[model samples]
Target: MHDLPARLPGAQRNLLLKHLPEPRMLCTMRSVKLLPGTAFFTGRRSFAAGVSKEAEPLKKLVYISQSNDVFTNLALEDWLYKQGDFKNSRALLLWRNSPCVVVGRHQNPWVEANADFCAEKRIPIARRNSGGGTVYHDLGNLNCTFFTSRDEYDRKANLEMIRTAVWDTYGLDLVVNKRDDIEWRGQKVSGTAAKLGRDVAYHHCTVLVHSDRSMLQKALRTGGVKGGYESKATISVPAKTACLREAEPSARVSDVMNAIGRVFLQNPIEDKHGNTVPSEAGGYQLLNPSDYWFPGLGSTRRDLASWDWVYGKTPNFSFSRTYSLPKAHNAGNNPQEHGIASVTVTLHVTNGMVTETEIKENDSFSQTGGSDLMHISALKGQRFTEHLLDAAVQRTVSAAMNAYPRGSSGNHRAFSPGPRLTQRSLIMESERNHDPMDREYVNSILTCA
Candidate 1:
């Protein structure tokens, strides 16, 4: 945390110091100074002369983000947490994104999101600087971030402010659960997460107003097979989610945002003398996120949108897929040619890059050459992405086809290369085949997650 100047510029100092209550909060506008490693207070002494003086009354602000981009909004939060002075002020930031899946700082995007679905729909994913469960964000979902000094950081207080706002404005009775999420009739309508800093802290949460629940469910799931990905990343705790509009049809994102902002500013701020003081009401400021307003903010947004921070930061994990090779339909009743063969490919990934590859074939009748390993070795330093993984598998299968010419039973059994082995391929084939176990297999992966 950068040390505040001994005194602010004349105009700014007057603006901040004017809010201090007289007598108790004593200090002339020009005499105020902020020493390093000390709370913002007037340079005054108590009756004993050596005792600490009371600090100024807190000033509160409410800011509404003008941009809907997830990375830009996240950058605003980072800027406020790191640069904003919260010693005498508390701030509330309300924002909404176009359509994105936000994962926690310690989360794995591959495990928390459906890569194929996100890619097909073109919904970007972002990793926040807070540790919590994953969440889906859209224009209909309202995101709230409360900023305060580290000493005044309180997650419950922030949650209660939201709960009060919802109930008071919409007559919706919401309960704050043990996990800090606000529930409507036992279904979660809001989820909470927070980031703490040395001098500042912010608690952010998501409130579902009228988001697409179907898309939320599909986008939050991964395409990986069950028991395939093994990671130590923090997995999200699944919950039965509900939107505020579900109970109250008229509930709107704007109205809810206004209500929350109103409640936040209406609350009183206390001075160090235990006096309840009216909070400095800085009505909602429409924040246009840019480098002009917040220096180095563009860099922060870039980091949030970069691959190194998104997928490359994922914890080390391993994924294994086992699939059977379909035999030729023309091979009639010949047990030797009809042998059941399955191939299992296990890959160990570190820092979102393939570090190890293992391939094994369970063939009862014949054995193929080690040509597949040659192609698999190329994946050692490649990214553990669906596109790269698919390409590698296809190259391996293509090599196998060239090694043994099809329709030639002279040298060895004709090798039949099946569909490219991938998470999406397994899902599509498994579902199209209508195997009950296939359905169960896909659903079993997130049990541990």
Candidate 2:
């Protein structure tokens, strides 16, 4: 962890000092200073200090009002990451952004979104550095971000807190489904995703109680296969989404917000952490973090909004099909003589060597020949020198020849070669051959037969 500055510029540090009820909380914020230009509240302690010689550290809570913009959320997350707040404090941020489609970091947004539709409707698209499917958000949706120390964070526990809060507020039994979705009456109402940092983590989720289901359906259309090529991509099965208002006609966004606030207020007391404010001191005031906006920080409107980052990150591979003539197909008199024995192999290659392979063949030659070509194609990108290929082919051909007598008709049987080399390796060899700036191309010779 980077050491925090001893003193920060301006009176922002003083704000925290003034708000803190207990003197000990100052020690925690004293080491670091807020950035020179930003405004932050200081000096309000979250927990009461004990008089005993050994006192437990007071817990700090920062409440931030929600923004209806995607860029604002990204900016807050980025600022928290830089300030190291993710390591020290727990943050509860509330925001209901305009309609948008948020995609996981490793996901292909093109597969998860209807870009043209979203563009036409003016709905923003965001990509987060988390592992999960895409989710839809709108003003009617509530987004809660929980930032906590990695060591103390429990995803399930945090989710349960939200569940308990909703249940207590609305008397609805929202069940957590197998896919980590919060559902009511078989309709999905919320979805969550988490991003883990080195010493901290951020878990955020969307509550869909009042979002426009029709808009979501229209904005999340699936595009057909790409490049006249068909390969598996991450897929999301659309489901019926409902808002809390549908089930409880009396429910409002304000009611939900109050329930959430109650959950946070009751948290400290329930956890055996005494409240710093006395009963006479009254209910804790929920203060909104100062508003600071920067257009450059809006990734949803810029980089994430681009197709290059969403689709270009996908790993590239090639699938090729080859065919041969079966003995029956080769015979002039046979009716099947014109039929072709075809094989289609799909190869996945990374760093040159094939990592995965699949093969499919026609039914006519099934009995005569069928091998795990899928497994063989896996060797397509494996580094093999000319010497190695020559040796292996010779050894295999010699073995097959020795098995049959030279005078036998079977001895004339032709030997079929293995799968072709992967494109990456061919490109590397070609580059090495023609590039004037090329350095030595290291060589490896395989003696394996």
Candidate 3:
């Protein structure tokens, strides 16, 4: 382990103080002094000290944020990921989220999580620019990120520091499995993933503090798969996960984080007998990520939080599922009140939009499942996105309606119920008042796929 205790003594020797210009400082109003060895700095969380305006290379530093907003916290990491010359510096970021499910960069959101549940509960699904299986987060979960140059990207060493810190502080035995996951007894305590840049790389991991296990599992599951889905998108592997509090009932996130920081600081600044200790100057810098503190921080957060990055980046994938249509085929009918026939929904999405779709309505609109829809050529070029799916469905319904006779009550009762099941009604039926599992199926079927 790095001799942290020996490294922190002079951690702040070169500290310089600087304050943001009054006009752009939305979060802070006072001038702040930068931390020792300070060079570049930037947040709204709280400042242990301030940031230096100098260009000197900073030594190892530690930061802890009070923001639990996943988007904001993840954005904070973005600053470290894209900025700074990490070659000679090591910085650690500790954060937590309110309650969310974060997926890897290349994974499929539809396949990796219960997107419907998250949406219904107003819980956001965030995408981090790293490759790893899905992980659930809540206030009980602590995120630890270590930033270093590509040459110094050592995940095992970082994991060891956390493991050792917990053990050394609480006398708990945590095992490091072959995958580098930290386990208590046989259950996982932490899971890690990383992102590599041209020069800098960061390894971030989730430390289960006292998370809601039920929600974690529910959020990570694809809910109930109607039929099946196949994709090259990374699939999440199941592991027995336990929280730090499980082993030490009294453990707190702040304390655990501090313990880890202590171990990092204890690393010898020089050799085993070196006189310098970086921790003396190094302390937790509280940051609320903002453009004022870290330039472009907001944009990075927005990019990460945007639909394009969160869902559009998903690897091209397909879902083939069978569902049942309601009997009330009429526009004003309550889908849940009547029994209908079986239907198949096949969606081929690329860039998280509808590239190709096949919806076979066994009992479509009480008609013979029209042959006219054959050449509708479908939403092949538009986004099959979460929020946009309904609009697409509206367009499809309009086209299909137009294909039918107007005032057709004369011959086809199917064509006459238009007034009751207006465009809005159809949209709601598929989204609500049905089995949540098949809601998406209903919505896509209406896309006339």
Candidate 4:
């Protein structure tokens, strides 16, 4: 066994104690130990923690998940929103994901994020069931979800919980901005978003407790498409973000969680419609995201984790971009004798597939002997992406190369190297030499936003 450190810093000490059950109220609070592959739909286990001999009926409950998987947490949120018989009950879910980026339900991942960077880092991008700007999550982040009936849904009221909790616990004042975001000083520390179901509405916010700010910025970086990109997809509102850990060195995730829990348990809730409900000092339930505990939750989890629901749900969009191709020259005859040309592409994407494509060659290149334009029929019905488009062009170029060899006076050359091969060859070379920023632009346009 290892011995404890002689002394932990003040901040570290606070963090260690924050995770433990408050000694004064251990009898009221329940600590659930979750094991892997455990299946059982056991009803919420409620003990008489802090219950007076005449304790009033409980109107609200706090369900904290032991899991950190974003997909699992999202599935649990969905289940809670749809759970039948959710009458006067209120719930606060304290959760955090390992590491992931979640986009809004209607936001286009291609337009709102750097897919290549996220993929390289092995961080999955999720499209939550709510409509909001994209946000990044990791262990240092905390997710607090407040559930209320659809009739009594109030966003401002929820933000207040975060505001009051932080101020009361750490003496940190949080400014609730007009956008409903929690701000400290001038930087956004927490962002709020909500989803409304038929019967329930839940407002969930991301608390930047100790997130890697650099990684968060990198994951949500959406660059490129310099020429011009237009889409109906939701645009993200960039904010100067701050973390609780940055604000307070000793700040632990547990501290923030407990602060919110204490406020949720002790304070009364008032809706926008002038209805106030008081909650006693109630026990918070720690639950594991298990299908056994919540029937049909397994299927919900699968669907949320599926690609079709996430990427497939994006609305149709048009992608238009111009590609610069390399100069074509007959190396045998004045290899330097070449001019500039371009390929302008406008793709109409429907259901993530290119339904119609318009490929236009610029004035730099001209067809030979009334030669028809490169047949872009192959491009139709293809996945509207940059990589796929380049592949398609390469196929056409290969075919042209095979038909025509150099010294044929560019006759056999696919569209000949000059005006004939201008569009295809130029695009291929430029893409090969594309700068990282340019590649990001290309990736943005190629995607089916």
lDDT, each prediction = 0.71, 0.51, 0.65, 0.66
Q: Per-prediction TM-score, please?
A: 0.75, 0.54, 0.70, 0.74
Q: What are the runs in model 3 whose C-alpha is more than 4 Å off?
A: 1-36, 43-58, 222-227, 269-281, 323-343, 359-382, 385-449
Once fitted onto the true fold, the runs of candidate 2 whose alpha carbons sit more than 4 angstroms away are 1-62, 86-88, 222-234, 268-449
- Collision pairs in model 1: none
Q: Give the RMSD in angstroms, all C-alphas superposed, for model 1.
A: 10.2
Weakest 10 consecutive residues of candidate 3 by summed lDDT: 22-31
Write the residue-wise lDDT of candidate 1 on 89-127 in tens digits. Answer: 788989999999999998888889987798999999999
Question: Per-residue alpha-carbon lDDT of model 4 for 42-74, expressed as tens digits?
Answer: 323223323343443435667788888888889
RMSD versus native structure for model 3: 10.3
Residue 440 of model 1 has an lDDT of 38
Residue 24 lDDT (model 4): 22
Relative to the true structure, candidate 3 reaches a TM of 0.70
- The lowest-lDDT stretch of 10 consecutive residues in candidate 4 is 33-42
> Residue-wise lDDT of candidate 3 within 67-179, one digit each (tens)?
78888888888777776667556788889899999988878877777877888878899888889888999988889999878877879889989999888878989988998
Worst 10 residues of 2 by lDDT: 440-449
